[model samples]
Target: MITFCKYALCFAMSIKKNNIRLLQNQSYSWLFAISLLVFSSLSYGQDTSVSQENDANKPVIKDDFEWQIILDLSLIYGPTIIAGIEQEKLSEYLMPGLLVDISYKGFYLQSNQRRSHVLLGGTELGYQLFIEENWQLDLILKAYMQGYDSESLIEYGGGDAELLAGLKEREVTIGAAIRYSQYFEDALFRIDFAYGSSGEDENENHVGGLIIDSFYSYLLPYKNWDIYLGAGLSYFSQDIINYYIGVSPDEVLATRPEYDAEAGFRAQAEIYAQYPVSESWSFHTGITHSYFSNNVKESPLVDTNQTTQVTLGVMYVF
Candidate 1:
């Protein structure tokens, strides 16, 4: 008994040491990101000053924020596939609900499409922290859903004794994100870091995680249409993967064993097009595909390793 106790204590100490090291590394990464932003902003400021002096005779375009305050109005409808679910007949296909976007100057808010039956999609609000001709930065807030409410999953054995005896409502994750965008003549590159927090998972359990995403996009303009292609890689923390997808010991049954998901990566690609129908009306459509990593794919709750999303809609600029 004494030897066992000593071994347990040593294991506990090792875990604590590892946690501290992880925290230090995260802090260093954040510091480095902030430093880069500050340096870029200073350099851009000086360049802007020089350009103003060179173009003194050119008429400055006054921002019409006071006159045209509201930014965008749109309506979108589309059929999308929700992948990686047990009940394909009920949860695989869906018609997206209302979509809206509003913005002013550097601040914006938008709703995104749901990719899974377990999720309620999310709302993203962002404010530009810094902007220049080729570089821009934003601070963002996103409200994300982690799992399906028991009521919604009733068809998939929500209250059944064997499969979902203790299922509950989806956990909401509110994330604070930082985004950096770089613009080229016909391409754009973006990187994002987000820290997510969750209050309770119906069991009153607190959860938190982090994500990092990097993407590159290219545009092709032909006639009245502009087409875009984009690709990206995403990283999710272990805490997030576990809370949303992993199975717990108590919740495991004969068929579903306990699972502990680790930090993982995902790859994504998208193609979209926009065509102007008139001065105020425009049509837009896109399709996106995401491939999950083995850590996520190994979950018993998952049925597919990849998911696809498609949307078609129209927008009105006011």
Candidate 2:
């Protein structure tokens, strides 16, 4: 009887260890897969030249020597978890930002401060690589931060009460993207492929990821109102999913077990309206809803599978 009990215990232990190993290997495989996808997508149109043989006579907007500057102020509210903590509700913030653009010939230097990944606001620096009538490619560097403060497990009275603090810090990534845009009578379609990786996060965690985005929008003009309706779809790579949502062995506690996050997808819809109040000022309001995938929603850190964001702001052009 004693021998049988011991054997049973050993078998259970072996099974648990095997499961953890399997998850680790799968995460690594996903990382490799996204890397391959990024490389292939960047090389897709490298050798071919887009022909303008018959369209050369078409008029092009050559604002080559122009410098565009804009200042914006807004109130934004949303919750996004970089790693699970219950205090993400406090992360909502106000944004006062600036945008500057200068172009010479077809090349441009641009900088914009705005909300980026997970609703975290930051600055983006980019250089236009190839620009034409309908397509453009850029090399970009972006700064990202989850928030200044992280959530503590004690804030939520659960089995995770003993878990450590979950504060995340800022990191930066460098990447490239190719974007194509087409306009019809009153609607426009845009699609882009972007991939980036950061060396180490504030928590010393490795982070890298890829995203593909497609958007369709329509503009309707009524009196002094410009209404915009837009829908977007984005694919998030497994590496990124794991970094933000997965729980590793070191992070696992009694209540949080190891989780392996697969690639996920997001669908979003938004409606925005802009009304000119003066020659230099405009008032805008927009609301957006984003739905997360199962892979991300299944994470122990995630409390909700969907997020809704609303913004009311004013912009001034200089």
Candidate 3:
């Protein structure tokens, strides 16, 4: 009985030891799994923080500005009168002008003025919708007024009894246009086209026709300056000129005029350089050459065709 009791104690001891080992192995396995889970979560959180920081440092792009303005002046020296039977010498005239461009987001207002045979003022209100980073489309309503002094009119009456008549004409033009601009490392290119009809009795009678204008410009590289070159062409029918000049085929025939203009065209070429000294100040110098068709140059009564002009001015941009 004693030997059997001793053997039973030994067996009991061995079973207890094996059971403890098994429990320890299971506890270690659970602890390892929990640790691995904690490490994975910590790694994910760190990556998220890094990503958010990068996003916070990203740059923002702004496509709107407060306002901009441009002023221009030109000295026009050319033939003020041309007639078939006679020709007039070239004369010089000072044409000072201002242009203001006010913008808020996509809306804009523009006003311009110049002096020539007539003092002219022009205004436009438009909405500029940006299609891309460099391209914009505009829908604008434009109006212009041309006022001339009585002395500016061609004298029809002879010497002491000469009659001087002054006239004021105005026109409203509404049009839509697309403008495309491409930016380079140091230069910019812009191209635009616009078409509109004039609305005024005088414009309809004398200046009536479709008006189209376009421009192309390339900026100089690496300077606060740019050089631009452009050309323009306009055609006017007999009806439009007759209304302003007071000479039509019927009227000319009735008066038996020795020479007269029937219809005409005007062409222009221009080159200018602009330098910006500050956000609100600039200097500009330019030259313009204009040519008028034979119909206008050969007319006996009027002679403002075929002229060349040069101008230098300082501008204030707002």
Candidate 4:
């Protein structure tokens, strides 16, 4: 535990300059998370047994939190999608994210296509609405897609500044979501229905959009490597489309004509590999590709029809 705290402080001191990140080929995030939970539980059980046996002999330290923290420092390479992002790009991949695995009851943020910040212990603020043997439902507060704006563009991909000069900044949001997860022997299927609100429209009206994501992931039980394959489709509503990538008449320029985005779909495919070097160290890498539909491609604010993310990194588990 002392060693773990040292690692935690080390991670914090270098959080911004750190280059490694977890390659969430959409599935490996949960895959590694689950593995950490299993190992943590086993460790805690052993500790508890020893404490019980020595109860009368000595004072045993009671550990309140039995959790695993992983530092995934990845060097990611990917294409730029949103305009005005080149100025914001610090490296090849804009930025890396840190993930925490705490043993708390809540709905995990399933698959949100939009790029958002990873909130520490963010998945803990959820209540289980229903639970069965392999299926469960939860109402959760999670980081939702902030629509397309400067921040997401900078981190995920970058582009020309002039092209997006006149665009409105979409605010980031954490909204409510209903998630359903199904577990199988070697796979997991999840669906999320979420809503995000950034701001009011030009008509002084508040508006929000609905997003539905369906994700399926399977794990290959390779003795030497942890391999995950994932595919998913995210459906965006018209309001969400326009809020993020669409154009309105008030904000249209001569070069960028007014265009309303039709509700459309974004498809993603991911493959990831993780190899454990020892009990606490491992090397991991993966690639994720998401293709935007014509509705999104047609947006003047966006310059690319697809985004590809690739990462090579090392993970330290304590």
Candidate 5:
């Protein structure tokens, strides 16, 4: 009976050991499977995240086309002079104008007619190549026409009598331009550069140079309104300035022979508010300040000093 008892004890211990081994193997198998599943899921989630991030980085494309038309009128309210004659009081600076713009796929065609004492008109074809969501390069081809009165002519002495005799009151300009625009959530900023040629008479040769312009606009958060401020600067060579501001040598000799009229620099500033009635139309009002340099202002035939103007108009955006 004692021997039988001992054998029973040995068998029981053996069974317990086998059960332990089995449980250990089962636990290891479960752990391996769980680890593999977790790793696979983690890898999948990482891939999905990367894909979504790449898609989010892509730019939004606008495929629709739009058109806008604008009309403007303004008055010169302060002491102002057109060419050289000083008009002491508020006079009619009839600035009746139209602007048309058509845009498609980030490209635009623009045409404008503006009179501010001088009849000015221009046409431009431009393309916007976006660098990012809020930045773009604008390439443009522009042609402009500006007309001045006969009194605005700067007299030049005896160059070619025939050529001088045929000089007309109109000056026409054609130019090409490039501009950069940076857009913010509530504002936009831009800088532009241009080169152009102008001519009045058949004998007059066209000259071209740098034209710089810049503007900043801020949108008021409360209302359907925007405030815009801008300035422009232009530089032309002596040849170009002489073409426009030149006085006749004979006239110079008779008057102030020491005065040399030539193209220099011009600067102007404008501040405006636009209140939108709808998505397509708006009421616009602004103040403009124009200053001519000593070279331009000193011309006896031209009023080049500081001049201020108030303008009110309507604009449409498509």
Candidate 6:
């Protein structure tokens, strides 16, 4: 216990020394990055529908294409450390998104790939390389890093608003990915090897970058409800890290200095619960926590090493 206390003390001191946090806010300006993509569909809110391999009871599609549509409405409340936070303030966001999944033969396009794998998010445009009963492989273009505009900076918690002003807008990072997914009766696993490319954002990053992601989700089917537990780990090369959190030489200030981000890792875990009200409507809620390593935390542009959020929503399948 004494050793733990000492370690905790040292960690606090390190954060203070590194200038990692200006203030803790109830929300982040990058809310779209988390809310829009992460909880876009019924996969995170409502349960997914999948056909098992070797099961002859599945229905055959009579059309030239297969499609699924989901509409989601959610309220997200969270604690964030952004560039500005001064008062004791928290934020709540009402987020809405409509997702479509369409597949013709082995070619597919998805707005929320979360339905493909319980632990994955964002858009996926891909061609299936191989598909067997319980496993599948694909070549894909995957979008991950959520984009943010510079013009809409608000002080939700506490920090210097100027720190986020006058910066070029950041765009979503879409990269080429080789992905593998495995489905089980009550669980899902996925892994991806991605090579990032240049984004449309004004800021430019170096070339030759890699990102690795692995995730797992387990479902607990209670008599009256369904619960999903998930965890994920991602590793990014220096170039990829720099694009999201780095401070260019030209944008440096006395308070927000230039920061060159190094290769780092992010960890995420989530728990979601759903209660069905009818054949097409359900109540959903979830809590997610994401953490960054020192390579990201040390940057002056980053305020906290971690963020936690809770979501409440409803889902409708059409």
Query: Which prediction has the highest lDDT against the true structure?
Result: 6
Tell me the TM-score of each prediction against the true structure: 0.63, 0.64, 0.52, 0.69, 0.59, 0.73
What's the true lDDT of residue 194 in model 5?
A: 70
What RMSD does each model have against the real structure?
18.0, 18.3, 36.9, 11.2, 35.1, 10.8
Model 6 stretches astray by more than 4 angstroms: 1-64, 78-81, 85-92, 111-120, 154-159, 200-208
| Candidates' C-alpha lDDT | 0.50, 0.49, 0.39, 0.53, 0.45, 0.58
Per-residue lDDT of 241 in model 2:
59
Clashing pairs in 2: 150-167
Q: Candidate 4 on 105-191: residue-level lDDT in tens? A: 432322221111122113324556777777778776664453344333333334344465556665444556787878777777777
lDDT (tens digit, per residue) of candidate 5 on 1-318: 000011111122324445434544554444454344434433232211110010122232334686656554333343333343332212122233456667788777865221122121145688776657767677877643233324222221112232223334434455577878677765666566777566643354455555554545444433333455555554555554554556545444333333455666655676666544444444456675656567765655444456666655444443
Top model number, TM-score: 6
Question: What number of backbone clashes does candidate 3 have, counting pairs of residues 3 or more apart or in separate chains?
Answer: 4
> Which prediction has more favorable lDDT, 1 or 4?
4
Off-target runs (Cα >4 Å) in candidate 3 are: 1-65, 69-96, 111-123, 129-135, 143-207, 221-224, 236-242, 245-264, 276-280
Tens-digit lDDT track of model 1 for 157-198 = 222334444644435567788988777767777677988776
lDDT of 2: 0.49
- Candidate 4, 49: how far from true, in Å? 24
lDDT (10s digit) by residue, model 3, range 1-318: 000011111122324445434534554453454345434433332211110000111211223775555554333332233222111211112233456666676677755221111111135677765545544456655532122222222321111112222223222334344444444443333333444443444223524443333323333322434555545555544534433344334334432354434655566676666544444444455665667666664543454566655554444544
- TM for candidate 6 is 0.73
Off by over 4 Å in 1: 1-106, 110-123, 144-146, 156-165, 199-203, 316-318
Model 3 scores a C-alpha lDDT of 0.39
Descending-lDDT candidate ranking: 6, 4, 1, 2, 5, 3
- Model 6 C-alpha lDDT versus the unseen true structure: 0.58
Instruction: Give the per-residue lDDT digits (tens) of candidate 2, residues 1-318.
Output: 000011111122324445434534554453454344434433333333221111222223434686767665554554443334322221123344566656666555554211221132223445556556554455555432131222212232111334335423222344455655565566666555777564554367677777676677677666555666778777767876566556667677777777888988777787776655445555556776777776676787666667766766556678
